[model samples]
Target: MKFTTYLRQGAPRLAVVDGGDLIDLNDADAQVPADMRAALRAGADLQAAGRRAIQAGKRQALDGTKLAPLVPEPGKIICLGLNYYDHAKEGGREKPDYPWFFFRAASSLVAHGEAGWLPRVSSRFDYEAELAVVIGTAVPRHTTQADALGHVFGYACFNDMSVRDYQKRTPQWTIGKNFDRTGGFGPVLVTADELAPGATGLRIQSRLNGQVMQDANTDDMIFSVAETIALLAEVLTLEPGDVIVMGTPAGVGQARTPPVWMKAGDTIEIDIERVGLLSNPIANEAA
Candidate 1:
């Protein structure tokens, strides 16, 4: 089942995509949470409720509905860097035995169709297309990589926008990666069962305007979802609504001949096989 979050009466409301329409889960059944986070925490019971709602056949046209970040406020927005070998080689970085993790704040999230700000202080905005995993179950420490993927709920396309200057100012990438509205989170979340295990072997790409800029397959990731989860679980409990942005590929604008950067009025899009498309417009922060 495909799930999405949109605004209803000024607050986030969870919906299940049925063909070209969306069924508002809350309206269909009160047992279904009104938001994605709550539904995730509700676990299997919520899934059953959503299935029942679909059976009831109450749905609204999906076109142009206002959307909210898929998770709105993920407890942790963890990201991987240089998770693709080609991307690592292109960026002049060596492959590490461990995943390079970073965090993006909830404040930086912008949903699909929303405007992502081009910060006034920098013109070096670059796009990194990635596959983001949403955790559904709480994972305990010492979980094996083999068992780690069972904790995932679903997957979504993500564009991890970055401000180059600030990212280079310090060894830590938090400043550069945390610019408000830089994280393009979703259009819809495709349940884990709908895709190949660990979401590997899927094609992922990014488009600038209508032109394709980054293209690669999820199979290229250096750290698989299960491995990354196990690695992360060692450090902290992976809880429901926590997200893991499985790093981008080799075609980012930063590696271009003279470099390419996003500016006002540009549209950036991320398309991951099975996950769905996530697109956003760029606007000047001051505007």
Candidate 2:
């Protein structure tokens, strides 16, 4: 089932997506938490709750609803760089043996339809369309690939926006990747049951102001979600609400002949077939 976190009275409220409407999960079942992160942590059968909500909950029109990040306050937000072969080649790098793991602070999260800030510090703002994995169960160190996916809860589209200058200033890409409100993170969350295992084979694309910029399939990723989870679990505990953003494909602004940076008033969209679409407007950070 598709789920979303929308704003009501300036507070985030979880809902199950229905035809042209949203069913308030908490309103349907007092047992269900209003927050996505809390619901994941609570370990309730969200799909079941969502189904119940869709059948007999408070219904509200979904059109033009303001949103919040899928997991508004994720426990951990891990990301990978150059996880796609074409993307690696475009950046003049060889295929990586291990995923270039990075962390994004919760503050970097921008909900779908929100403005993606173009920092005043530099003009190299760019976009990277990525697949976001939301952890459902704790994955302990040394978890095997076979068992890795079992811990995943759902998937969402993410725009891993970048400030290229800040990214290259240091060896670590976190500087540019962690800009507040740069990470576009929602629209809807599709439970793992609704898609292929590990969410492979789905088409992923990015469009800037109605023009396609990046296009690829999830199968193109060098590090599969299960593999990434196992590898990451080896380093640290992957808890509920922890997010793993599988890297982007080729066609990022920096790879173009004339780098295409996101400017104010531009709308950037990340669309993952079967998962969802995450769209955000570009705006000046200093404004």
Sliding window of 10 residues with minimal summed lDDT for model 1: 41-50
**lDDT minimum window of 10 residues, candidate 2:** 54-63
Global lDDT scores for all candidate models:
0.91, 0.93
lDDT of 2 by residue, 1-287 (tens): 88899998999999999878999899899998899889888898898898888878888887799989989999899999999999999999999999998899999999988899989898899999999999988898999999999999899999999999999999988998998899999899889988999999999999999999999999999999999999997889999999999999999999998889999999999999988878899999955
Task: Score residue 285 of candidate 2 by CA lDDT.
Answer: 91
- C-alpha RMSD by candidate, in order: 1.1, 0.9
RMSD of 1: 1.1
Largest lDDT belongs to which candidate? 2
Which clashing pairs does model 1 show? none
List model 1 lDDT by residue over 164-214, tens digit each: 999999998989999999999999999998999999889999999999998
